[model samples]
Target chain A: MPDLPIILAGVINGLLAGGIYVLVAVGLTLIYGVLHIINFAHGSLLMLAMYAVFFLFKPPVGIDPYLALPIVTGGAFIFGYLVYRWLIGRFNHGRDENILLITLGLSIVIDNAALMFFTGDIQTIDVPYAGRMVELGAAFLPVPKIISFFAALLLCGALGLYMARSDTGKAIRALAKERQGARLVGIDVDKLFAVSYGIGIACLGAAACLLMPTFYVSPTSGHAFVLIAFTTVVLGGMGSFAGAAVGGFIIGITESLGGLLLGEQLGQIGISLIFILILLLRPSGLFGGKG
Target chain B: MSRGTLALCAAGLLAAILYPLVVRGLAGAGVGVSANYLINVGMLVFFVAFIGQSWNIAGGFAGQTSFGHVVFFGTGAYCSTILHVTHGWNPWLAWPVATAAGALVGWAIGALAFRAGLKGSYFALITLAFAEVFRILANSVEFTRGGLGMLIKADQRPENFQFRDPMWIYYLALALCVVSLAIAWQLTRGRFGARLVAIRENEDAARALGIDVYTEKVKVLALSGAMCAAGGTFYAQKYLYIDPSIAFGVDKSVEMLLVSMVGGAGTVFGPLVGSLVLTAINEGTRSLASVVPALKNVQPLSLIVYGAMLILIVARLPDGLMGLFGRRKSGKRHDA
Candidate 1:
């Protein structure tokens, strides 16, 4: 028989992990769907957002980190737009290797710039409810983790609805599926690409803000979650929204369960191994359409 | 080959070989020689060059950009360290074992990733995930000594391959660099290289032409892994220490890619030149920091510089520094 408390704790952590993974993977999936590029800088952008919220919440402003989410997201959106217009747009139809290399270089620049500004010290917000826990029978769940989990679910659901019903969203999807058809239909492909990039960055920015309540903010902290996000994206099938969501939960659970069974370190290794195995077994992903 | 080119190569080799002797003579004449600093930079150059060449096997040749190469490097370092520290095996004996381990790991990853039809960004993501997994596992294992790191026995012995002189380590690293370049050059000019290029150009076409895409990719990945493992072993031996952060770090993987890209990916001499240039920049930056106190606390400025340089190179000089020299005009014919 399993220990009920341990299992419950795992479940709670899994949910939190799933939420965070979704936040990271959503941007990557969006970039892939729209531009067919991986946006290696996506993780670094998350780092930038974390710092933005961190600074905005400091001292004179005295705004709560969570409250600064809008500002962070807005900043990321603008930054993303600029990046798409100035950097990514220049390389349309370029080789995939070139895109990867360029984005990787961008990631380095963002990460190191953060490091230079913030001095590499790990800084965490001391929110009023930071360490507080809620009791669920025998299991105690952290408050911040619960908020993040629900927040992620709500945001993803909203985004899904917007994409399904909104005019701009439809145009973006149309462009993603068939560029020539979208252009024939009078959709401005360049503007659509920029908007999608902005939205992707905005998602990451919101996630960073949400993450500050639980995790410490550091220049390289994005590196910690970036790989997990990538794993989720792959597990869910590249560019599949629902897949990203489901994959996020699956990965989250795997990490939590593996941690409980093996150890925290082995948990990550186990997740990676499982991700590879899944890729081997199902190339198109569990829920993805055939390539 | 032109006389000038041959003379240049000869001159570079001679200068590298005699640099230590020149420094020693200068020191004997009471002119200060920073032999330690030079050796440190030189070792970095060798390590970066070795990693770049290894990455070029998959990324430059096969056009499969993998972001997780540090996993093999970390594996090699950890395996060699465990063998020597726990099992009392000789470092020389441990090198092949580590390389074998890397090869096996690479084969497994390639088998899974390639079979799934993951390419480009997808492949890079998978590789990055693998590295992260390795890092997490390394950090959690008590046997690895965790974040505290595993330290080798301090008393230096030639038999143990431990050295007090930086020159010994420098020469060893230079030898490794040379060997790695030789292997890369040979592979890039062979039948396998031709097959890799064909696949890179068009997988479907390559398959139509009777190429076994999966097998070839796995083979190249394994070879690359083995080479990287060998490099890692030498790195561990040279430093006399190993840590999860240093061994399995993502930065290490990025450093390799950056060096390769900067020097000119797919070219034989690209990795070596990239490593040398980057290493020089790194050393120059550190020395500059000492001269200017304000710059001392600016963490990751060097990385920022590298990143900016990479972006500039990609945007303006896609062919890199080697392209400017006109060494391999034929390489341009196979642009992705």
Candidate 2:
């Protein structure tokens, strides 16, 4: 057994990791809710945001990567909106397989394009605060990761509040819950879809910016996080926003505890296995409303 | 079978058997051809076709769309390699055990996933998770040799499945391709095949019609896994090595899906055509890279092409390449 301090550190690590997972999974759940299509390219979008932040902070511009979050988020939002309008809008409503195939294609294109542009060498932002550590009485935590954790929680809260309070957010939620009914009430389905996609992409972009300080970015970097994101989303419930957030934390904690108890390699697999078990036991997820 | 169907089958069989000989003769006659390269490419095409067909059973016919079919491939490779290397068992004898293991694993996954009512994207995620777990397990286990991977023993006799001749390996792969294709054709044409299509089209309706959806799905998954496992066993033997990265990799699973989609998922001959085209593209790209120094950094170009093709095919030709020429008349005829 590990010491008490070590266990505490593991719990904290899990919470922080869960925060990042929520950032990615929430976007995924949002897209699924409106479009009824699981955007397979969602991870690639995160990778693109990371690259954007990386370039924005490169030598000449010299803007701090963390400071460039707004630009990255905005750019990703526009890109996501355009993608939905031009590419996703063409598919028939119930043809979910077509959406899956198309998004997969887009992911491949984005990943390869990044490969061509950035090459395969892994790149990371060398933020000043990235290496800094905060020492507690018996535990140490990386500063950037702590910052990322808070940022995730704050953003999620803001997004949740916005959805609950804002008129546009209400419209979007109505659109998700009942498209036909929303349309009968005169909500613009197309416009709502585009906005929802933009929001999703913006969420991913913010996550990428937050993650930039702590993780390496590469052409195939999105692939590493994408599967985990998918697992989190599924564990949270296919299209449930609150479920996604809760699911992210659950997965994050599982990964942390698994790493502490098992080896590092097994930790990832253990998290995935736990996701599978949860899926088998409760396909809708812990917080997911019954479909 | 119809006369046209028999003719097509005969032509395909002749082409498969004679292709190697024709290529060998061309090389012998001092044509601008490399027999070794041809054989290697042929082996890849055969294996790709075999695995693609295997995946098609569940993905295309049943519409489950698993992204982790490589789990079976990896299991088969590991099982056969362990038996051969550790126990000194014959490769031919080890194949059944490998296939059985794959079937068992597939059945377990299908039973759990299907019973829980996971469908579509969720099912895909579950399968992908399973593949990752297998890869991680294979990577961490000492007996599997971890990251260093496993290599066939040098100075071993040819009968031990380590052959000095690429021709022998080519023939074995080719035979497996034929067997796989035959099985796919048979499975897709029978009552079980009809039941699969029914489930794919509408599970609720199929269940209303008294179809045992759960049992059928598991059976299809198990059968597909067994076929993929057979391919893996041959792949391990021919490569004279096995590794978690190569065997259980996500790329392999994507390749299988791409081949089926490109060639036309529900069609019997789709896998063979898709495999040949994609393998040729892959080999050609690699060759071009070697010849052109400037193109050396195009690491994932092939995957990009595959992804693009998948999107285009699904969007434009949902019926796949076979739909371009003509629909499979049998399916329509039977319906009528």
Candidate 3:
């Protein structure tokens, strides 16, 4: 049997993977909380940001993926803002299924467009830390993962503070909690909704920037993370930011440990089985029960 | 039956049977020389229409928009292919068995989801999760050949479901489409169907009105899933191949959704209309590319068009093409 330290490292690495899921789930939760629309295209949008980082890392626009974070995230914020203003706004009073259908459609378009423009080829952004690992006692942590882990926590804290203090953030919370009450108080509900949507997307953008250093960006790669994100969101309890973070870590650890036990292929099966079980056991999810 | 509906159904049947014959006649006369292409496209149109019709029963009538419908399709394909290739059973003989397997899966899924009380987007997401899990299993398992793909010998034997001419397959698919359309028409044109529509319109009201909402949804899902499996078996028979991706890909689920939504979600003729439109759009783009060199490489243009179409349908035409006639109000309820 392997030493306890190796198992400890696996658990740690799983938690590391969970950090990215945390970022993704929090964004999805935030959007669902405010917009009452599940953004099925969230993963695809994140893929676009990944491509942005890939391109920004090369040629005359050369910059490190980390360095391009502010630009890509800011760009995503603006893009998301436009999406809210134009695309989603059209369905303000539409049926719940409309959002589902439109987002499914958006995913199809974005994924196919990427395939057309980028030609289905995998694009990797190589960082110097690709091969670097940090040793701790008898365990090891990859440099890229470490960077992403910290970045995710940092963004989570920032988001937490923003929601707690910022006027726009408070407006969003108010709008989510009591739309009529907020409106009576002269809150620009629509504008606040758009801002919340943009913030949700910006959170995704940060995760994408962090993910680019370690993962290959492809039109189809987002499919995996999309499932993972849904799993995390569901487990964390829908529309709960803190739950999303915790749920992310749980899924991460579950997937990682399951992978270690079952040899990767069957590992995913076990992990998914657990996900279904969780759903069955707690229809409301593991944390907050609200939508 | 209403005169208009009767006439429309009769006209549709005539067109379906005659369309292939006309194309074959054109081929015999050596005119246009693209009759074969037309026939193939017609097959796909019918194939998708049948599958989409299955989707309509569960998603449209029952109002349980499943995003993992390809699960049944994959089940049927794998069941039939495995029975035929490994057990040496005739492919045609294997189809009914595969279809039964598919129905069983549908029942199991319905049991789990409905019993668990998953509704709306939650139901859809759980279905998607199930499909993904199955996809991974299919890709990993040894008997499935694990992403290497499966192929049946092309040996021309009618007994083994092999055909010298592709037209036979096309006709078979068309027959399946007609049968499925007929089934859909029968189901949706009754008091039971009205109950389904009511359930979709408002689940709580349906229950309050003494409708067995759970039983109706499950039954509809089983029927839909079984029919979808039949389409899958036909696909395997026609192509004589099965791969994990081809069988259970999310693309297939979306294809069904697009066809149902594009035509009209709760309308009888909507899926067929959606199928025709999608076929024409894809074919139109491909044909246009043959003439325009610049457009040749942008194969995804059609998909982008589809995406835009989805958005347009949801945003503008919630009732799809049926809304154009102003015959009925939108079945989907507006969100506050």
Candidate 4:
């Protein structure tokens, strides 16, 4: 058995990792809520954003990842909006299956394109503050993880507030809840769909900025997040923001504690098993309303 | 089936049978064609087509849309490989047991998922999760040699299922493909297939019409699993190596889905057509890459094209390339 301090450290690390997972899951759930399609390319898009941050940080155009956040986030938003407009929106015939295939196609293209241009070599950036640690009780956490955690919280808070208060946000919510009704009520449903999708991907951009300091970027980097993100979204509920937030934290702890208890290789089974159990036992999820 | 369609099928069969001989003849005559290379390519097309047909049975005909059919594939490969290598069983004897293992897995997954009333994307996601679980398990278990993988000893004899000539392997793959096509054709002609189609079009309606949707789904999955597992065993024997990644990778899942979806889901010849097109694209890109000095790592370019074609197919040609010809004979076949 591990000591109390060790357990506490695991919990702390899990919570920190949970922050990033929350950001990713929130994006996914938001897209599902609005568009009713699981964006299979979500992880690939994140990988792309990470590459963007990497380029911005390297020699000639040297910029800190934190500073590159705004640029990447805004670019991701526009890219996402156009993608929805040109590709997804054109073929989205209200069929869940078609959308899934389309996104799968998009992911295939993006992943392979990355491999072609960037190669398979892993790329990581060195930061002065990367080694800096914050000691809280028995936990020794990296400075970047701490910053990322707070930033994720602040971003989610702002997104929640925006969705609740802003006119566009309310319209997006209405559209999600009742699409035909929202359309009858004179909301530009198509444009709102694009906006919502853009916002969803913009979240990935911010997550990339946070993730790059501590993680390496590779063409196949997206494979790691795809299952993890799907698990978080499914565990949290398909289309619930609050559900996703809570789900992210639960998954993070599960991963942390699982690694602590089981060896690293076997620990991964916990996430997949949890995903299966959740789908079988409670498809609606904890905060979801009758999936 | 129409007379034209039957004649076309006959011609295609003839071409397939003659392909290896023609390649060899060309090579002997010092023609541009390479016998070994073309034979290898033919084998791959048939093998991929066979596996793709397995996906077609469930995903295309039944509209199950699995994102992790590789679970069964891996199960069969590992099952046969382990039985032969670790337990010291004959490869031929291990084949049937391995296939049965795949069918069992498929039944279990189908039973659990269908019993829970999981459908559409939920079902798809769950299958993906199941594959992940199996992958993790395969990576961790000591008996399976964890990540070190398993290797079958090379004994190029007729009884060993290993062949001295690549032509034999090609013929074996072609035989598997023909059998798979027969199975798919039977589905198109039988009441069982009709029930599956009904379920695919609308499960609630199918159930309302007194069709045993659950039973039919499970049966189709088991059948599909058996076929895919057989292909897996063949693949393992041909390569003589089995790894957790090779056996259970998501890439194989994607490949299976891609071939079926891109060629034409539901149609009997869809997988064959898809395999042909994808293999051509793959080989074409590789040759082009080798010819061009500037493009050092252009292997992914083929996949990039595949991805683009997938997107285009989904957007413009929902019925796939087979759909193009089938469009001329509308209402002749059941299409989702």
Give TM per candidate.
0.94, 0.95, 0.96, 0.98
Model 2 C-alpha lDDT per residue in residues A29-129, reported as the tens digit of each score: 88888778889898898999999998998989887867888888888889999998988777634546668778888888898889877988899878878
Off by over 4 Å in 3: A1-3, B329-336
Please provide, for model 4 over B1-336, each residue's C-alpha lDDT reduced to its tens digit, 9 standing for 90 to 100: 789988988998899889999999999999998898899999999999999999999998888989999999999999999998999988899999989998999999999999899988888889989988988899999978889888999999979999998999999999999999999888888888888888988889999999999999999899889888988899999999988888888999999999988898887888899999999999988898889978868999988998998888877776688888834322122332
Candidate 1 segments exceeding 4 Å error: B1-3, B141-143
Window of ten residues with lowest summed lDDT in model 4 chain A: A92-101
Among residues 3 or more apart in sequence or in different chains, the pairs in candidate 3 whose N, CA or C atoms overlap within 3 Å are none
- Ranked by DockQ from best down, the candidates are 4, 3, 1, 2
Task: Give interface RMSD for all predictions.
Answer: 2.3, 3.5, 2.1, 1.7
What's the CA RMSD of model 2 in angstroms?
Answer: 2.3
Highest DockQ scorer:
4
- lDDT digits (tens) for residues B231-331 of candidate 2: 88888887788888898888889889889888888777778888988887787778878899999866467777887888778877765676676546332
User: Which of 3 and 4 is ahead in DockQ?
Assistant: 4
Interface RMSD of 1: 2.3
Q: Rate the local accuracy (lDDT) of all candidates.
A: 0.82, 0.84, 0.84, 0.91
Worst 10 residues of 2 chain B by lDDT: B327-336
Task: List each candidate's DockQ score.
Answer: 0.60, 0.60, 0.64, 0.74
Score residue B218 of candidate 2 by CA lDDT: 95
lDDT of 3 at B43: 87
- With candidate 3 superimposed using the best TM-score fit, by how many Å does residue B126's alpha carbon deviate from the native? 0.7
Cα lDDT tens digits, model 4, A169-273, are 999999999999999999999999999999999999999999999999999898889888988988888999998899899889889988988979898888899
Candidate 1: clashing pairs of residues: none
